[model samples]
Target: MNTKKQILALVAFSSLFISCTKNDIDIVPQNYTIPDTYTFDRNSTTSVDYSGQSSRISMLQEMGDYYKTQATAGNEVNETVLNNMYSNSGNPFSSTDLNTSGKQLKDKTAASTDYFTLLYGGGSTVEQASVRTFFQTQFTQGNNASLGNNAAVGVAGKYLDGTSTRLFAANGLEPQQVVLKGMMGASFMDQIANNYLSVNKLDAGTNVIDNTNKVVEAGKNYTTMEHNWDEAYGYIYGGDIASTNSFKFWSSYINQVNNDTDFNTLKAAIDLAFRKGRAAIVANDYTTRDAQIAIIKEKLALVPAVRAVFYLQEGKAKLITDNGAKAFHALSEGYGFIMSLRYTNKPGTNNPYFTKTEVDTMLNSLISGPNGLWDIDNISPKLDAISAQIATKFGFTVAQAATVN
Candidate 1:
C-alpha cells in the first residue's frame, strides 16, 4: 500500500482494537455533558433571600438620614431610634426584624446585626467590637459642636469627620454614605467574588455533587453547592435583577461602570459568568463550573481594582492642581478600594492578590504626612505603584485597568 493507505489502515485497526476492548469490558465513559442553559428557581428553599439583605442596606441609609435630620434640626436624639438603628429590636427598614425570624440577617446579634457592625465587624471580631463601641460612643456623646461640622451632621455621619467637604454630595450624604458605598464593593461584592464562588470551596472533593444533593436543613430544597452559588448571586443582583437603585449593592457599582463603554462589556460578562456558573452546577459539569467561578473572581476583582486606579489618578490630578478637598475625596475612595483588594479570590492561592501589609503600606504612603494628602507632593508615583501592583497581580497592565471606571 502507498504511505497514505498504510496510515489509514493502521488508524482503522487501532480504532477497532479500542472499540472491541470497550465492548468486551462493557464499560462506558464518564458523562461530562454541560447544559446549554439553566433556570434558577428564585423561590427555591435553597435560594438566598437577597431582597432581605437589600432592605437592611436601605435601612442603614434611612438611619443615616434620620440621624442627619435629627442632628441638623438640633432635636434631642431619641434613644429608641438609636437602639432600633443599631440593633434588630425595632428596625425601621423592616416591619418584622429579619434577625428574629432566622431570615436573611438572622443569627446576627442586635449589637452585631446593624449595617455598620455587619460591614466592619463581619470579618474580624475586633473590628465588630470596635464598631459597636464606636456607635455607642457617638450616640452617647450626642451631637456635639466640639466634634466639628461633619460630626454636627449626625452620629452616623461622624465617620466623615475630618473628611473633605468635596466628598459630600451636593444633596449631602453622611460619612456613612461613603462607608456604605465602600462596603458595597469591599464587603458585599467581595463575599460573592471570594467566599461563596471560590473554586476550592465549590470543588471540595464531591461537594459539587454532595452539596447539590444533600440539603443540610430539613426544610430547604437546595444542596450546599446550590445554596452557596445562589448566596453569591444574591450579593451582586439580589432578588430583583431589574432594579438599579444607587443603594443596592451591585447596582450601585454597575451604574458607575456603565458610564464607560469597555467596563460596560465587563459588567455584562460578569452577569453571564454568574449565570453560566450556576447552570454548570445544575449540569454537574465541574470543569465548566470552575471555569465560570474563575471568570467571576477575575472580572469582579477588576471592578474594584479599576475603580481604585481611576480614583488614584483623579486624586493625583486634583492634588497637583491644589484642589485638596477633591483630592482627599478621591483618595478616600481609592483607600477603600485598596482595602478591598484583600477580598479577591484567586485559584491556588490561600490569600488574596494583595496582602494587608501591602494595602497598609500603600495607604500610609498616601496619608502619612503631617497634613495628609494636603502636604503630600506628587503622589502620582505612589498611586502608580499601587496600580501597578494590582495590575501585576491580576496579569494586566495599568493602561487596561485605568479606563475601566
Candidate 2:
C-alpha cells in the first residue's frame, strides 16, 4: 500500500512538471510579414445601406429652406407645403412611391412619415404619439399670425423678436437649424469617429483573427474585419460609395476647411486615411488598419474642435463690432460644436476626449453670463478657456487650433 501511494505522488509531480513545461514552451509565432496588398471579394450582403438616412437629411434641409424663405417673405404660410414636409400620412420624404415615381402627390393618406418624431421616440408608439402632439402644437402656433412674425414658421433658429426669443430669434435663423446641425456632428460624425470605427468594436477578440484569415462567419457574406470596415464606411458613405466624390457627409465640412490653407493638409489626409483603412482591411494588415483608423478619428475630431474655436472667436469679434445677430449665430454654432466634443474617440480608453459634464460646463459658461454674448464685455477670456479645454483634450495647444485659419 505504501509503494502504491508513493507511485501516485510521483505521477502527480510528473504531471505538474509536464504541464509547466508545456506552458513555458508553448508559443504561437506571429507572422511578421503582412502583405502590402491582397485580393478580396468586396461584395457583401451584410452592409447596411444608409441611403434612407442621407435622403432624409436632404429632405429636411429642403423643407427647412422652404420654410425659411416663406417666413422671410412674410407670406401666408402654405399648409400644403407644411403638410408635405412631414405628416401623419403620406409624408413625401420617406414615401417610396413619391421618390421612385417622381410623381408629385399631395396628402396621400400614406401614414405618418415624420423622421424626427420617429427618431425622438426611438420608434416607440407612445413616444410617437407624444411627438405628433408636439408637432401639432408647433404647427398651430405657426399658423397664428397674432403670436409673432416668426410664429408661423415651425423651422428652428428663426427668432421672433429678431434676438430675444428661443424658438425664433431676430436672426431669421431657427434654433432648430442649430440643433439639427449640431446633431449631424454629434450623432452622425461621432458615430463614425467614436462608435463604428472605434478600436473596441473593430479589434475585438477573434475579429482581427477572423479578418486576417478571411473567415466568413455562418450566415455572414463578408469576413469579420471586412464587415467592420464596411460598417464604418456605411456611416459616412451610406449608398454613396459608388460615387467618385467620397466627400459627401462629414467630409463636406472637411472640404470647407480644405479651402483654408492651414487645414488643407488635414483635408487631404482625411480622405487618404479612409481609403488606406479600407485597403488595409482588404490586405488583412491590422497594423495599417489600426494606424489609419487612428488617423481618421484624430483628424475627424479636429473638424468640430477647430470649428468650435473658430466660431467662438468669430462670435467674440462680431460682438465687438456690435453685430449682435451675427454674433449670436456664430455663438450658437460654436455651442453645438462644443456639445459634439463628447463624442471624440480616445483610443485605448472607453471615454471620449471630453465628458458630458465637461461639455455642459463649457456650454453653460457661454450662455450663463448676464448678457450672454450681448454683454458687450470682451468674451475673449471665456472663448479662450473653452478653446484651451478642447485643445488640452485633443493634445493640441489652444494657440495652434486658434491660429489654424
TM-scores for candidates 1 onward, in order = 0.66, 0.63
Q: Lowest summed lDDT over 10 consecutive residues: which window, candidate 2?
A: 105-114
Worst 10 residues of 1 by lDDT: 106-115
- Give one digit per residue, the lDDT tens place, for model 2 in 313-393: 777777778555556667777776886676566555544567656777997787665545554464668887888777777
| lDDT measured at residue 245 in model 1 versus the true structure, 0 to 100 | 37
lDDT of 2 at 227: 65
Q: How many Å off is the CA of 279 in candidate 1?
A: 1.4
lDDT string for model 1 (76-180, tens) is 455456555656555444445543533322122212211223332224555435434544444444433213344211222232323322223211222333444
In model 1, the clashing pairs are: 211-224
